[model samples]
Target: MPHPATVVPEIASHLKRLLDFVDPLPGDVCLDVARGRGPLPALLAPHVRSLTAVDAARDGRAFRTGPVRMPGDALTAAPAAPHARADETGHPTVRADATALPYPDGSFSLVTARFALHAPDDPHDVLRELLRVRRPGGRLIMADLVRGNLAATSRDRIERLRDPDHPGIPTIARLTEMVTAAGGAIRRLDVFTVERPAEPWLADAPDPDAADRVREELLDEVDGGPPTGAKPRIIGGELWFTQTWAHVLC
Candidate 1:
């Protein structure tokens, strides 16, 4: 398995793309549902009047990135932490269920959920709640793991396990239904799918021991073994996939 750190570059890139799709307006009240690590909320803080980060697990340490911290409960009225950095102003944390937001109707200008649509329990009701809190003409943007793009077999296996904690991945068509049913207008919906590269990064081979793990865990399946004489020059890669982004007007 690649270290989480090794994947940061790719994850950060995707996050930027997700945010670009949302394109929040200045002074907008933004709600980040299931804002796990606060990356997206922190990005929105400076651009919007205020940003609220919410999650079910509610880990303050994990979400705290320079003044931005995870919340305890959505119902509790708590103050946000001091801005750890200048750009992190007005980003507060809240602990709450995405399915049932604590705010009043039309409380926010935009609502966002990243990689949490796969959470157990149909997100249709939760999405309705998201739309309920948004002001007129507000936006709702979502980015989540998609099924059956690359490595169809692996995707099938993961979906079949049918873990309750991780509901089966939703398709683009199903995602559209949730938004439309919640009364959100579909303004811009685009899909960008790309396969993860098999070739490990240059820094991946930090030491001999680490190199062995990289080869075994990541490269071993390329052709069922190590590359052959000319295969090293063939630019081999992995099968992990990513969904770029999509958005809707609330």
Candidate 2:
């Protein structure tokens, strides 16, 4: 796909890392759980044979695709929600919660969830449910923010302010333990960092006032105040912070 607008600067690279880690098979049928208003399905469409997206949202936010471009586009994104395409080229969608997926046992060759685990209240249950639909020998891959270099409590405070539903991101050890407890064995775990500008990042906040509070909290941390654990800094006169992401391919 050709990307023209540089909407989300980190998107292209984020997709590249996910694609490499997923190593999608041309013949593999994929199931992406928690299709939260992200560009992932659009970006991964070219690599897989068939894909289905399942999200908890009934509003068309589930349909928003990513901006089209290669890595050089630097996180260019598709247009805003309710106006974007309903998914890449007719990939099907199922509206369902993660804890109780409607698929039969062993139904998919590849199951994935990205940047999604932190939103669920019962992440362990969610992981187990995802595994239930996987065919024997099928791979279950997950990518989510984990407890990283920042002070976790402060980081979570800023996160929750932006999206009240956000549960705290899990620590690396806790994340792996959840997967194992959910009947998945460790295959590979990759950890990396991604930098995001505070303004654009907070722009997605459901409430403007909450977004302001989040900004204030981050700013407070930067000005020698108690750390918010976001480790906020000024770059190009824009506030930026880094997040630790863990990709687990089980």
Name the top TM-score candidate.
2
Q: How close is candidate 2 to the true structure, as a TM-score?
A: 0.80
- What's the distance in Å from true for residue 144, model 1? 2.0
TM-scores of the candidates are 0.64, 0.80
| C-alpha lDDT (0 to 100) for residue 56 of candidate 1 | 40
Clashes by residue pair, model 2:
3-68, 8-75, 9-74, 9-75, 11-75, 67-77, 67-78
After best superposition, candidate 2 residue 69: deviation in angstroms? 13
RMSD of each predicted structure: 8.6, 6.6
Question: Model 1 off-target regions past 4 Å?
Answer: 1-7, 58-92, 147-156, 159-164, 194-221, 224-250
Which pairs clash inside model 1?
66-84, 67-84, 74-95, 197-238, 198-237, 198-238
lDDT of 1 at 124: 82
